[model samples]
Target chain A: MKDRISALVFIALGIFFLIGALRMPRTTEYGKYGAPGIVPAFFSIMVVLLCFIMLVRKQRSNSESSSTPAEVKRAENRRLLLASAMFLAYVFLLGKINFIVLTSVFLSVTSMVFLRKRFILTVTISVAVTVGIYYLFSRVFLLPLP
Target chain B: MYTVKVFFESIASTLSNPVLLFHLSWSTLLGILVGILPGLTATLGVAILTTLTFGFPPEIAIPMLLCVYIGAIYGGSRTAIVLNIPGTPANAATTVDGFPLARSGMAGFALNVATIMSGIGSIVGAIFIVSLAPALGALALKFGSWEFAILAIFGTIIAGSLTAPKDPLKGWIAGFLGLMIAMIGLDEIVSFPRYTFGNIQLYGGISLLPVLVGVYGVPEILTSLKRVTKAEVVLDFSKSERKLSYLETIKKNALNLLRSGIIGVFIGVIPGVGEDVAAWVAYDAAKRMSKEPEKFGKGSIEGLTAAETANNACVGGAIIPVLTLAVPGSAPAAVLLAAMWIHGIKAGPLLPIQHPEMIGYVAGSFVIATILMVVFGLLVTRLFLKILLVPTEILMPIIFVLCVVGTYVLNGRLFDVWVMLLFGLLGYFMRINDFPAAPFVLGFILGPMADTNIRRALMLKNGDISPFFTRPISLVLIIAITLVVLSKYLPKKRGEKR
Candidate 1:
């Protein structure tokens, strides 16, 4: 099922790129072969062909029987979804908030989610990491933070 | 003689600089720590360091990256020996003989043997780089656009095929997708936009650094969060015997060390095939050639030595193609190549002519890094054990922050951060679905080269495409690509027949 989904995603991406490439100027001052879109067109075509092959192969294999227990899968999915949501929120809120405060909050929340117990330890470590990174980049490396 | 002279001169030059040596010690130590962590890989180590060191001078930055590269590959063996978990993919084979040796109370001996073997392997690989890179670069000067275009295709195709042997098609799809992604910005030849959607940020195209961090870093953080397994140190290093008995074992297996080192370098020279594959191949070969084959996986020193040596040697091997062709020999080398570009150093056929000292400098850095790796490997065995005890839940959040900082610092753009996040999710999806990321990266690196050259080859020939097949080097590369694709399928077809 995962393979099939991936195959469909890839195929869609390939077709999208192929259409985009086709719409671009196909001839340049250099010649027909020097078209700016030629390479992209070729790559998109290859992607579509290869993904079709993969889709076919996945269908034929019929080996989607997962050995992972349902409970374990559910737990894994929950962790994944939670972590992903936190990451998305962190990126979205990055520049809007102060680097230190935002990062500390983000890290503290993630640590709490994953570490579960030990709230004090998680929050402390999160603040420490945020400050440590802040100092290391700004003071030591002289690199700017977002 | 010229290579030898330059090698020593470069080493002498670097040693004379106290600041460079200081950088080397810290970076190499940091690399070892990165390697000892289970989910963090050498590629991620190099990628993060590449971003952090973006402002440093090329001389300082490049060597630091090399130290991290060499040290990370060697460091992974520690967790392999102690915890039966390969800290990095490169050390997977080491666990077979390594953990069993630990189980048999020879963990200290195995660790010592692996350190010595890693040092030897790196030295051998560096020697090859000093000798072979110049020759290969000279030969590359003969290659025209036709050859380069075909070579780009060949590298991506072969990388995809080998990196994901179980499903080469998925690898190919990933590689092509990378190539297509490389087309997103304005067309290089003309100013016509390709896929930017009229956004000013997209005009610059997606930066490689953010993509790299996203693809390698984010997935590691997410996947590590999902894994619940915890590892404990099998034995304390100080309590185990730290005698010179392992040196005697190494001395007896000198032939195995040399063979494995050669195997590692050869594997490294192949674009996109990294240390993990080299270690496995060397281990398998050593087992076949072993006097006591049954001793393998049952605490054989020879097996441990073979795996460690090849993987380290592969580091040097992987750099060969990077220096000569600008096509990375491994995933980490790909990052190293990008770091070089970021530093305004152009690698490939013109490298020898443009930066003649670079080949020697790299070889010297590899040698120095190997010595430091060995020294630190022996000196800090206990420290690594403590590091191994750090809970992943705490460690990963810090790493993810570093990843974000690393990505954002590259261009100071929030858009790049979004790119990193998207790619990270894509990378995780690809990982779960069994698609390899190495070929995608290789394709991205080679995309411009392939795009510009194929068109240039056509223009030079007045729209004729025949030369891509007819040219000598192009023909060889074409045949190689065809063989790589067929090798993946023909065997399966034969199996089905059976």
Candidate 2:
């Protein structure tokens, strides 16, 4: 099922690239083969073919049983989704908030969520990591942080 | 002989610098710490360090990265021996005999053997790089645009084929996807936008650092979170046999060390096939040649030694192609190539002529790093066990923050952060689907070279593709690429044909 979706995505991407290649300038000084679109067009065709091959191969393979129990699998999927959401939020808030403040909050909250029961240790470690990174980057490496 | 002189000079200079030695020790230590962790890999370590070392000069920074590479490869064996989990994919073969040895109260002995073998293997690989890489680089100087284009295609195709030996189709898809993504910015030839969709940020094209950080970093973070947390593996050091000496271990596996070292260097020189494959190959070869073949999985010292040696040796082997042809020999080497570009030096045919000292410096740094790995490996065994206790819950968040900092350091654009996020998701999905990310990276690195060279070759030939087939080097590359693709479907023979 996942393979099907991936194949469709690649096919769409290939069509999109083909359209983009068509819009690219064709009349370069060295003629059609030297045009900027040639490589992209070639890549697009290859992608479509490869994705098709993947689709065919996946179908031919024996059906694989899910290794995890349904409930455990669902829990893992939810955790992955939530973590990705948190990361997205962190990126969005990075520039607006102070670097150390935002990072500490992200770190402590993530630790709290993942560790769940270990509050004090998570808080202490979060603060320490934030400060240590700030010092290492800004003072030691001389890199300016966001 | 000239190479030998330059090599010694580099070693003397590097040893004289107290600051350089200090940095080398520190980075290699950090490399081992991360390598002992489950999700942290050599590629991730080098990528993060690449961002951190932005302020350092090329000489100090490059050595530091090499040290980390060596340390990480060796460090992975520690986890494989102690915890029965291979920290890095390259350590997978080690876990076969390593865990059994650990269970039998020979964990310390196993580690010592691994460290010594790793150092020996690295030294062999380093010798190959110093003696052979320059000659390869000189040979590459004969290549023209047509040859370069063929070489680039061959790299992408071979990487895709080898990354997932069982499923080359997915690898090809991932590789082409990377090439397609690389085409998003303005075309280098005509200075025309290819697929920007009118977004100004896309005009300059996506940066490699952010994509690397995101693809590798974000997925690592997410996967660590999903794992069922376990307390760190506790060691039983109370046994009297735990004090086994390194000299005894070395004496027992002398022949295995030499054989595995040769196998590792050869595997490392091959494009796409990395330490993981090298270790397995060496292990299998050792088993077949062993006086007691049945003892392999039952904790033979020879098995553990062969596995550890080949993987660590791969680090030096992998650098050969990167320095000579600008093509990476492994996934981590691809990042190393990118890091080289991030620094002022471009690696390729002109590398020897343009930066003659680079080979010597790299050879020198690798020697120091490998020796340091052995010294530090023996010294820091107990110390790393405690570090391994740190819960992934706390460790991963910190790593993710480093990822953000790394991506942000390159070009200082929020747009790059978005690129990282997108690629991170892509990497995550790819990982879930068993699609290889290494080839994607390989494709992205080589796409421009292939595009530019193919166009140049065509223009020079007035749109005739004949030169790509007629030229000696291009024809050889073409034939090699065909053989690689064909070999994928060919059946394996049971016995040695000869």
Candidate 3:
């Protein structure tokens, strides 16, 4: 079932990219051989072909079976969804808020989700790590961290 | 003769430099820490360090990165022995025998054997690099644009095939998807924008560092968080009995060490194949050759040594192609190649002519890093065990923040951060679906080379595609690629028929 879903996703992606490649300029100053889209078009087509083969093979295979209990699967899904949401929030809000404040909150929240028992310890460690990283990057390594 | 002289000179110069020595000590130590941590891989460690070391001079930065690379590969053995969890994928073979040894109260002895064998393996690999890289570089100089294009394609296909042995189709899809991702920026030959979607940032193409950090780093953090498990250390190293017979064991296994080291170097030289494969292959060969085959996985010292030795030796093997062909021998070597480009050191056939000292310098750095790894491995076995006690929940969040910061600092653009996130999510999705990310990365690195050279070859030949087949090196590579695909495909067909 997972293979089937992934195959469908890849097939969709390949088709999308193939259209994008087809729409790219056909000729460049170097001539038809040096067109901007040729390589991408070739690879996009290859992707589509391979994914189709995968979809066919997966349809025939009946070996995939899930052994995990439903409750465990649900718990794992919840963790994945929560972690992903946190990651998305962190990346999108990185520049809108102060680097240190935003990063500390992100880290603290993630630690809390995973640790589940130590709120104060998680917050303290998160803040300390954020500040230390900020200093290390901006002051020591001389990289400007936004 | 000149290569030998240059190798000695490079080693002597590195030994004399106080700054290099200082960097080497800390970096190798940090690498061990990274390796011992379950979710942090050698590739991630090297990728993140590449970003952090962007400000340093090439001399300092390159050696520091090499130390991390070598140290991380060796460090994974600790967790494999004590916790029954391989710290990095390269140490997966180590756990087969290492944990049983720990279970038998010989954890200290197993670790000592691993350290000694790893150092010896690295020395053997470094010797090969010093001796063979120049010849390979000279050979690469004969390659034309067609050969390069075909070589890039061959690399992506073989990487995909080997990395995803069960289903070569998925591997090919992942590799080609990476090639598609590499097409997002302006065309190299004509400067015509390909897939910018009206975004100005896409004009520069997707930055390799952000993509690297995202693909390797993000999936690790997310997966570790999703399935948080506490790993128990099986034995206290200080409490374990130290058998003085370990030295005798090492002496007896001299031939095993040499054979595994050679096997590792050969595997590493193969494009896209990494240390994990080397370890497994070497371990298998040792088991087959051993007089006591039944004792193999049940606390066999020979098995542990072969695994550890080959994986470390593979580090040296991986660097050879990177220096000679601008093609990485493994995933981490791919990042190292990118880092070298960022340092204004173009690595390829022209590298030897342009920068004669670099190959020797890299070989010297490997030797130094290997020595440091053994010294530290012997001294701080207990400290590493304590690190295993750190909860994954806390450690992962910190690593996540570093990934974000590492991506952002590259160009200080939030755009690159977004790119990293995008690839991270994709990488995680692909991981859950059993698609190998290594082939994707290899394809991405080689994408531009494939695009530019194939086009240039076509233009040079007046749009006649026959040269891709007619050219000697191109013809050989084409045949090799076909054989590799058939080797995977035909076996599956035969299995299905049964």
User: If you superpose only chain B onto the true chain B, what TM-score does each candidate give?
Assistant: 0.97, 0.94, 0.97
Name the better of 2 and 3 by lDDT: 3
- Model 3 per-residue lDDT at B445: 88
Predicted complexes: DockQ each: 0.76, 0.73, 0.79
| Candidate 1 Cα errors over 4 Å, as ranges | A58-65, B238-244
User: What are the clashing pairs of model 3?
Assistant: none
Candidate 1 lDDT for residue B403: 87
CAPRI tier for the interface of model 3:
medium
lDDT of 2 at B193: 83
In order, the Cα lDDT scores of the candidates are 0.88, 0.84, 0.88
The sequence of per-residue lDDT tens digits that candidate 1 reaches over residues B215-297 is 88899889888776566678665555646576677789999999999999999998888999899999999999999999999
How do all the candidates rank in terms of TM-score, highest first? 3, 1, 2
Q: After superposition, how far is residue B198 of candidate 2 from its true place, in Å?
A: 2.7
> Could you tell me the fnat of model 3?
0.81
CAPRI-style docking class of model 1 based on DockQ: medium
Pairs in clash, predicted candidate 2:
none
